[model samples]
Target: MLGASFLKQKKALEWLSALFLFLLLREWLLPLPSLSDTGSISSFLYLVAGIILVDMTFRSHWLGLLIKIIGTLVIFHAAFVEISLFNPEWILQTLQAVSEDFSRIVNQEWTNMSIISRNLLFSGMILVLVSLLNYLVLEQRQGLWFVFITISYLAVLDTFMPFNGSGAIMRTLMIGFMLITTLHLSAIQKGFIYRGTQSAIWKTLVVPLMIVSLAIGVGYASPKAEPNWPDPIGFLQGKSVTGQSEAIRRVGYDTNDKTLGGPFQQDDTKVFTITTNDKYYLRGDAKDVYTGKGWIKSDKQLESIVHPKNYIWNDTLFSGLETKKVMAVVQAEGEQLPAIFYPGQLKGIEELNPENTTLTYDTISQGILTFNGAMQKDSNSRLFVERDDSTLIPTPVQQYMDHYQLQAEIPVISEKKIIAAGSNYPKDIEERYLQLPNSLPDRIKQLAEKITEGSNNPYDKARAIENYLRSPGRYRYETKDVPIPKEEQDFVDQFLFETMRGYCDHFSTSMVVMLRSIDIPARWVKGFAPGQEISRDANNNMTIEVRNRDAHSWVEVYFPGSGWIPFEATASFTSPLQVNYDRLANEANEFNIPASTEEKEANKPKQLDQMEEADKPVVKTSAGFSWGWLWGIGILIAVGVWILWKKRQEMYLWWLQRKMTQYAQDDFPRRFTLVLTIFEKMISPRYSGETLREYVNRLQISGDERQDLLYLTTIYEKMLYGLKEMEGKTRSLWQQTIERLLRQMKP
Candidate 1:
């Protein structure tokens, strides 16, 4: 009858409901770090387990008050140690450390508490909370407040932080509603339960449970409406770029650079990978017009392409220049880009993965934009289509290219030919490439002239401006805390005179603006640098992985006889393309001064020369904390725990026997009671009105096992009834009997 009472269905459901409700705390605790500045607590799952175990043992009256306390402590020990619980030394050390933390908490030094103590304290708080919930749910039959609070917490997280609480919210509603309904029904049928009509509680809950379940199902299945307003969190923290909203600062490629300023954090998200014979800058697009704030494309026209064809080139500058064919294969890793990243002058597309993907060229930017199917319109639509009403609509492609092959004609640049080919700018090139906003500060132009005072040709003047911007003490490379231009300030002016520090965009924009100030036709070009070499083959072909951190921008100077030549003006960066400085001085000795051997050596192209050594500078071994090591340790701990759990019965039997020997010396009563308890637990639970003899007889044991069990039961009966004293022989027999019975008890 006692066992039957413990198995009361309604009571079991009450405990289950309380446990489920308490587990919801994980949803709140797990995302706390992401929502705040706190670091993640690693043992959070163990803490939750400890709390649940303590709650279960405390509420289980059959275990007796003393055993319940011991069990709770054992659980705490396991959670705190996270190692072998039987290791006395480790357990003692953990207890001492945890105790010290408790002292700190007592002194009101909350911040001084270590992670272990905090988790321990949090577990204690949850133990109290679950007890209170038991009273509220089972005794008082109320849980509306808990449900309401859970909803509010999840709603706040979903609205503000990156935490997606939508699934959690749905789950919370389902469970919370059911819990509340069950508690309400329990309250309504309390009188019936008191009168011993236990089925009344179950019957009363059936309809409410069904109703709650149906309501949850219908609500979940219903279509959700789009958010009625713009994201409040984004509106507050996001910056306006290209007339669109973006995160405060995260390094990546975006179509708009109309407003480019502010510190950006590095993102390791891989954008693409390239397989090629040599390193080259992967050009995305170029912006011809600089608005003093950022860049904008002058021409929005895109020319369609169905097959491989030479890209648009400034024939006046690139005419008859020696070119080498370079083939590269690019595999997209991140989101589909609006344009393909090509190296050098794009000759044409050799192959595409889908074989049906369409391509178009942005005439002004010279960027190749891809499409899913054959373009329905004259030109392929951009990712963001600007309508006539001045509103932008995003056009998502159905299929993104997996990989594409490119056939490019890389122009072999000659510094001698570039300098000797005087700046006889074409009408169109002069109009477009030499553009500068009217609002540009006059001091900026003066600074440009001052920097290039000794320069004669366009190439030399451009080189002088590049060297000045990247020169030490004048500007520094920085990606964080870079200030944006004010309404009255020019972007380039602020970087050049005030901040004097920025990333690639800052130096590149400044170089372009400075070049235009002196009538040197240069434009701001953005792409990825020669990314880190990830692997190399026997044939010397290299595999390069380009991440968001590799997203960069630079200046491209358009010389009439040399086409558009790429230049690197950012500090700590070297251009892959080489210019022959020795030949330049020999070709025009009167105008060009010979550079020193050291300078000429530095200027030599290191594209192929540095491929083998690329991994050395890019990869560094650190003696720091690693998640991989932590995961490995965690896996090992998990396996140990699983093994212990599987052998729990045998381990408990061993521990019981060892403790019995110790208890016999000073505390025979404890030893006797413990033996009887193990018998009831391992064999069968005691029933109401059943004597010790009757319980033993019900076990129906055979052979020697039956005798051992009966003898242990008799000792338990003697201790419980009147026999308060036992001789040494009787106690020894009792211990032996209990040990033998435990050994014979198979799990």
Candidate 2:
């Protein structure tokens, strides 16, 4: 009975030791979060301690199983929390929102909270929850299976879900848990016999040595921060509270107090400064579609060619009014120069020059001119272009009609012959013309109906809507706060009825929808608002700079003889948007101060003056090694040294043990003493100098024959010298020898 009890106790101790070894392997191999962050290290250590206590307990069989189950659950819970797989959708959405909010916050836009703090808070909460779950469910052993199932479900979700930062973290944790579990199981099967003998040496020397080496390496690799770091703020830091005003003023635009600084400042200077020799219209944008809300470009099938002859030009026959010509040098400051230089009528364009230019005229009403050159190049230089805006002759219209086939394809007008005037418009266009949103405000519709009560024709109704919008009673450009109801479908309805204050998008959308309600063909047109004038360079050229704030959208209305006409229906400015030519020239002269100084010093002629300076060579410096690199290198070196030292020590010990096994006699007592001496040397301070005789005398055996005593000692010696291959066989022999010795030997 006593032997059976001892064997059972030994087996339990072996199992407990095996469990701890498995845990140690897991921690070493996997990239789990540090013990500090997770409290996992303490939990695991406590679990090992608990196993030891259970082994000593009177009822260790059940108690040991309970402790192991609890410990395993705790470990699982910690891993789960670290990965953060719970409520994945909410987590992803929250992270996305935080990223967007961080962008806004960096730009000085409104954000509810700091993104970093939010992320940290969320991570901490998850960590705490995981800890709690481990403590409650895992410790109690009541929900171990449930916990496993939950983890499995989360793992599946993580695989199927879209890639995200949180999902990545969760996957890492799940993989870690699986690896740890596998390693732990393997270690448990290996048993704890070897580990029990080796633990003291590893704990005292091996682990501490590794930890100290790593610490030293880290200390050597870290870099010190500079005592006086240079100020890193850029040009914007020097400007006033309204830095946008300074930016605008630098571009030769007058800033107003109401403009509001930062990115929203509106420059009052004209984008283009035109010096014309003749009285001709400088057209900018063309508005073709006539929504009840506003005028926008018409949606006509884009033709290969966009010229005046393709559409109605004027109401008269061929006349000499076409001779009204103008040669203008127009300098633009902001926005790209449109190929259609103006919105009104034009006859011809000549002598057009741009540094980087591409012209595309697919729409009959307009052309796009994209300047590929830099805006800073044409500060004050004059670009000469001739335009002829004259009354079109009826003969030209008749000639155009004779040249191309015409059908009354214009929407909402009846069919008629091609003519300059009195042509019947298509009636079918009227039915589909007015298409308003179903959720448009009743008040807005009522207001629109009231404004165009007497209008019969589509043109008249469009005019009424345009006039009503342009009038003082409608709207302004000031920012207004309006909380949109959750139930609202269309943004236009909310703006027109509730807010009544918005930029071009709101106004244009509202206008188009309203016009559709009243059987008018209208569409939205997006383009750049006029830019401010900047200094010009030599060769008679000027620059136009367009910023993001200049984006504008409006509406267009089509007319019978004139084609699409533009109308400003949203918010009218006090002054016409134009670039100040004189101011731009003055700024250019001011900018030329340095060049003028050099020219005067060199006695060079003013006519020979160069506009741009040559580029200078920049000094280059390579970035030195970073702290992270140094630390990595240090760690590698430390690990290398440790491995080398461990290898050398292992080799020395192996050579010594081999020599002892070969030379030492197979005398059981002597061999046992040699093994004990080696173990004492390996363990150092903890090991006492206990000889075989002393140890045997201390155990107080009742009776032991010389043979039994020799046999037990021999088995022990064989195990120590690694002569015995199987621990179980050696242990069984030791036990039988011990029993006989105990029966025969006296104290």
Candidate 3:
């Protein structure tokens, strides 16, 4: 009965096949958002398919074509423009923008195109794809190739990216099998219609459907064991430094840094906001041990600290340093982290909420982990607190420290002081910071020594390494497309010698490792850069909003007298930590600490005209003189040529008629003669001895051309041979006849 009903509808099986193909196509789009910035792709694709199906269903071809055009325009409007589709003014504006961007694409200025233009192009491609799918399913009655390509695409994404394609694969398999079955049945139906026969295709489909269902059920229900062989892809890609495989993860600060180096998308989710007078990097933690691939902590001992009584910076040993007190307040706005965040050289905590919050500071990492209430310490220095005590049971650490205030003593040592303080060994610092893997390549050390060849002191050596890594064209600041180092490759070695492009981790790690190779005590520090300033309060304090995108890492070089100094080694990034170069410029003549070239240029006083020019906004100019006029002239010429090519036949005919009319005003005889010459040119010149009447009859021309020439010959003979002077009305009739004859000739 079901098979009979499908055959009765005539179009049911075809539509069913198309619907199944649509579902299969949809699976290919499911994982797009995770891999790119495109969002709501499924909705856009659905809109396209729905409109295309509507277009295919219309009875009138012209009407359906018109509907398809309008529907495509509507989809473009919805996808790229944030306005109502019915607004004619905005639609025109959007189309103009698209046209301008189209020219940019023609010029191959791909990077300059805005995101809107790119998405517009994507929408156009989708429109074409759906239209093609229409033919493949309804006309060609085949979609097996499309299904195979989609499965391959999804399988690769699943293997390489964080996308899970198991469910998509199952759905695709089911839809593909059904779609093929329906197309076959529809083909059988078409044959029956052609042969004037009748058959129920649904009856043939029932057996395949039952078999597919049983197979799917058994495959889904069957107990499966783990693969006998390990993942071949993992072996091919090789293990990370942590001896484990890693997939690309989202960009943010996480507790784990055991495995590093891969692509990550920017996350703009705000984590915290800081209000302070001066910009400072929000330090999270530090890692001392380098495993050639990533950083790890060698020490985990936590020291307890209570606010107002104990200062975190008191343990540091330093001398001959200029410093000032700075203060900041951090407010947690997003998901709270498990640790407390502070700036450099934390003096002490002035305020913490709930009055029962406990802070444990890791001596090596300098990272502060928070917990509830007064807690006792185990032999390992881990915090232990009574859970049952009503007073001790405090609010969540994040909630308790949701908002806090602290003061930091920022060091501002000049280059002269740093250089004068020679290398004085701190045994623990040297042991921890100078440690490198035995397996590290020797070229890294050689490169370090080569970079710092002329430098005499540790400070100069460190600066040399930092400058070399960040020099223009030597390295690039890329967030994504950074590959994880293979098992045999050291992360820093590969970056410095092989890839030469990556994010902060690549540059910072290379610098730290290089510095270590030359015996400069350096450690890897991870934190947030001084974030973008959102606003300033009435008191002149700046409020900076820090997001996950602001997460960064840098090299911290320790000097004997000046303590640890932060240096930025990432390309296109500047260190926020300020150094007062002029403070000791004249204090020590022997040391002669010349300021960096950048600082010298920055310190130079500007003249009145120079200052005025600097105050003005800079305008971007093209290379050399503008040739905009030349481009305009070229475009005009191109337009004219195109018009001539498209309408050459009509223009030629009009020109010939205009010339005939001009000659007719003065002499109708000359006009008639010109018509005869034109007709001769169109076919062939009269034979040497042939007269006009003979030429017209023997021309071998047929249809309207032959008839027009024969008629005109009679008129010309009457005027020339019969000597019958034409009246005014007869002359007009003669001219009309000539014009008709000319129209019959091909341009």
Candidate 4:
């Protein structure tokens, strides 16, 4: 008879386990509401109750397994769909809407609530009442009615009251309630016996009494006024720009000045606008000479010269010119400078400079023309340049320049000097070129040598190095945790030998230093990478916004007949078409600057020679850090802490029930011989593996006794999982319980 009774008990427990597994699977499959939602909490309670009912009615393992599998499949399907369709933006918007509505209802006078507020209040009230009903069911099962009621009231008060403002107090109370309620329900379903000495009435009464005491304590605490809502615009305005350096630095061009900083900074000031019919290149100051550091105009002295007879110029003068091109006036943002960038070679500049508006040059080998002093605020600046379509034409020479004769006055250097500086190339360029700081690493030079081997000419060497650095096999853009050191010697060496991931600066700087070592007069050029091509207007004018992401740097090498040609030596593989003027113009606005008769006449030999002296190199400073990094780091740390706390709560609940089973088996020795038992009853072995603690936890207990079991279990789990030592009362209770249970269970 005893053996038969044991078999029946084991069968019942097995069926119960199967039912619990099925319920868990079902819950996972459905798109349940967030834990905080009242409706979701109610649904969860019903589901748990349903699982208990099913376990009582069905003892078949096959039926339980089938239900579990089907439920798991449903959940897996939902998870897949959720992952594919997840939109963070929608979640944020919903939270914002909920918060706003809640705030409005709370602040409004009861008699004067708006329609929206009233509706929201009514819905919230309904949820609260339903939640209360669920709490009652939980209390009945656990026999902790007074405790549940008191805790619910305290939580509701904390959520709605002005005390402590909108802080963690409310959230903590709600979480505590959830924990108590879930523990109560799980215990009742599992048939666990509570071993606590305290009666249910006393345990239930103590919670309400404690809540009252807390309410009294809070009333005695310091009083503060309600927090006012912040103005969204004002909040945005107060944000520090220094914190957003990368974002700001991306758009680093001053449309007005047509000059780029060797180092970029973030500023969103608009420059000027353009409305044009034909596509044109917005010419910044042309750089014809490259030092090891950066780009500059040609070294040759400017000579005054008459305008070439074959030149074609736009007709636009100061305000309005009848031209096929479009025109636009752009405004500046913050302290950002202004600039007008157009496609193609400029025909003439109008109202930019009184002394030299018309720029009619036959060709610019590698040099760019600038309207001096035209960057000043009140000065009317405009670039009239012809668009060059052969930007993609390959090496030694471009085909577009075939018809144009080389000017006699233009400086002609030997091909060797142009390719590799003369015998004095290293010595002459050492101070400005091969001059890495004493702190620069030896490995940087080694890498440079490795990349440029066998390349005889400056152009070929530079190209070789650029291709190697830019190849997909060499670099990626992931930010390194331990960044390459900024110390002179360590920076480049670390980048080349250790962490090979970095942004454009590291690559360009390395390229410049290497070229200088080999007698090449390569320099860094900083400007917007390339603006997006805007749609053209009816008249064929395109307007572009040179945003923050456009900031870029590259090397410019001098070519004999063509002036300076641009080459990107960084790891970024931006296509030439993306940055090319004609292609961009074809997609965006094309403005034509008309050449005035006086400007055309003024572009004589005398003027060209006179203006050449102004093309000399100038020095500038570097871009550095602001105050935003601190705040970003703080936000990251806070998010990490919240995740840890949530995980701790889950582990605690799993441990509580395990300990309760130990208390239940203290009176029967043979019946509790083992916490977990394995018996083979079929072809497939049926083996059950569970900890003594886990088996104890599976039984459902209620009221004061249930809380006691939960408390002990939670403490034990924390000790075991957290690797903490059992201490004081908890240690004593665990020792006594184990001794008593083992003594009783001995055969």
Error of 4 at 273 (Å): 3.8
TM-score of 1: 0.45
lDDT of 3 by residue, 1-747 (tens): 554422223377877887887788688666654333233463466566775576457645566556776777666554444446666765555566568778777785443344445555555555555665666455555567667877886776565443446778888888888888998777656431223333446767777888888998899789999776423443454533232224546567777877778876556678888888666667888899999879888878777665533564663523467654567888887756767777667777877765677777787777877776665566765566646543433233432357788887555567777887778868988999999999999999999999999789998798778767755456755544478999999999988899877877888889999999999899898877766566677776778787776788888888886678888776545455545444222422111111222233343321100000000001001011111222333355345445654564565456556767666453655676667656554456655567777877777666666676666667666666665576788667666777677766776
Give per-residue CA lDDT, model 4, range 574-643, as digits (tens): 2231111121112112210111111233322211100000000100001111112112332453354345
Worst 10 residues of 2 by lDDT: 613-622
Q: Which candidate tops TM-score?
A: 3
Give Cα-based local distance difference scores for all models.
0.62, 0.36, 0.64, 0.35
Q: Give Cα distance to truth, residue 68, candidate 3, Å.
A: 69
> Model 4 misses residue 503 by how many Å?
3.0
lDDT of 2 by residue, 1-747 (tens): 655443333333234333433343233212111100121133334444444344444334455456555554443333222223353543354455467566654663321233222333333332333333232222211232323444453443223211112333343344334333333333333321334444443344345445555755565468957636221121223423233444322211111111211123333333444433221123334343333333444343232222323334331211211122223344454432334343233333433444233233334444333322222111222222222443222211101000111111111111111112232434643443455545456777787788779755655566467555444435533321223334434566556666565544555566666676655555555544433224345543333343333435556544444344333345432111111112112212211111222222332211111101000000000111112222333355445444644464454345445645564333444444434333333333121366444454444233444345456555665666777454567656654554343234221
Q: Name the Cα RMSD for model 1.
A: 22.2
State, as a TM-score between 0 and 1, how close model 3 is to the true structure: 0.46
All candidates: TM-score: 0.45, 0.29, 0.46, 0.30
Q: Model 4 residue 226 lDDT?
A: 57
- Best candidate, lDDT-wise? 3
Global lDDT for candidate 1? 0.62
Q: Which of candidates 2 and 4 reaches a greater lDDT? A: 2
Worst 10 residues of 4 by lDDT: 607-616
Clashes of each: 2, 58, 0, 96
Predicted structure 4, TM vs. truth: 0.30
